[model samples]
Target: MAVKTIDDTENYTIEWDEEIGAIVFTWDKYVSGATFREGCEALLDAIKRRDAAKVLTDTRGINAHDAEDQQWMQTEWMPRALDVGLEYSAVVHPDSVISEMDVESILEGMEHSGAEPLVTSDMAEAREWTAEK
Candidate 1:
């Protein structure tokens, strides 16, 4: 059977580095009619295939998303993370509104688990944080 390619993407930025085991994502470009959660789930699944548990999402390049997207990420996506033992990380501009909301969404996930996401404007800092014990 054919798999779910929810949408045929064009401008999305997604890459995985096997050497570093990092799933890098840059979602600054918006594509209409594509659900953000589906994109992320595809990414998460892709990274999981190679046991890449660390992620650094760049949200500075795109527009802000709605509450449903945020709730979907925090409530639905995060809980599923337990299955892969993933550690979340992010590199976001300090002034991006979407960045703030994403951090807040991750914080909401903390209520469900002791695990808190590491976020920073510096990519290195976020990567280091995610790498910590």
Candidate 2:
């Protein structure tokens, strides 16, 4: 397995980490609604192509997200992800309080999405947890 950068931009990078057999999305700055939608679509495509079941999402750089985007993630994306073999999701807690609140809001909807979710501020811990069956 080899690591591949799926999408890299000024705001974020979405990659496939072969070591963990997961798609990792790392935020480099606050993500606008359009950027967030683009990233999510790329992530879904990567997961399907790789048959990945785990995900590690690093949101520390994001300060906020649009309410409509959050709603889309919760109502549409999360369910679609679970349908496509997403079994575990490890979210790295954001440093910004506002971003953290957004994460919490998303998690509330994910509670019943059939994927196990873990919230942590440590990347290493997130990797370890996502790697576990």
Candidate 3:
């Protein structure tokens, strides 16, 4: 399947992976406030356009995100994603301790969201999980 670039910026890249029918978001740096919002919006648009229900997010390069942005992702984006048929999300955790903590915080908030999220340090594992029906 062809890979389609949804949004590519200096800080991150969001893409459509047709092989697994998932939208992939890879962060190259820490993002907050406006940058985070823009990335989320692009991701939402990609999900809708691809009719994707699964997501593979690679956060290994990111240092961390702002608390407010994390909250927005959990409270706002998560529900909106679910409403659009999102059912699963696989996150490849960052190496930095602080970044891992931030990811954990977001995951905690996602506990009650409709989508199921799996956190891991392995990208291949994340892809495998997202590939499951």
User: Among these predicted structures, which one has the highest TM-score?
Assistant: 3
Task: Say which prediction, candidate 1 or candidate 2, comes out ahead on TM-score.
Answer: 2
Clashes by residue pair, model 2: none
CA RMSD of all predictions = 5.9, 1.9, 1.7
Question: TM-score rank, highest first?
Answer: 3, 2, 1
Model 3 lDDT per residue over 5-112, tens place = 888999889998877778999987877898888888888888888888888999888767788998998788877888887788888986666766777788775557
lDDT of 2 by residue, 101-131 (tens): 7787876656676668888778888888887
lDDT of each: 0.61, 0.81, 0.82
Supply candidate 2's per-residue lDDT for 64: 64
The per-residue C-alpha lDDT of model 3 at residue 93 equals 84
Residue-by-residue lDDT tens digits, candidate 1, 21-124: 56666764654334567677776776567576676676666645666676777667777765676655554545666667656665565535655566566766
Q: Which of 2 and 3 is ahead in lDDT?
A: 3
The regions of model 1 sitting more than 4 angstroms off are 1-9, 18-20, 31-34, 131-133
Error of 3 at 56 (Å): 0.5
Window of ten residues with lowest summed lDDT in model 2? 106-115
Can you tell me which runs of candidate 2 are displaced by over 4 Å?
Answer: none
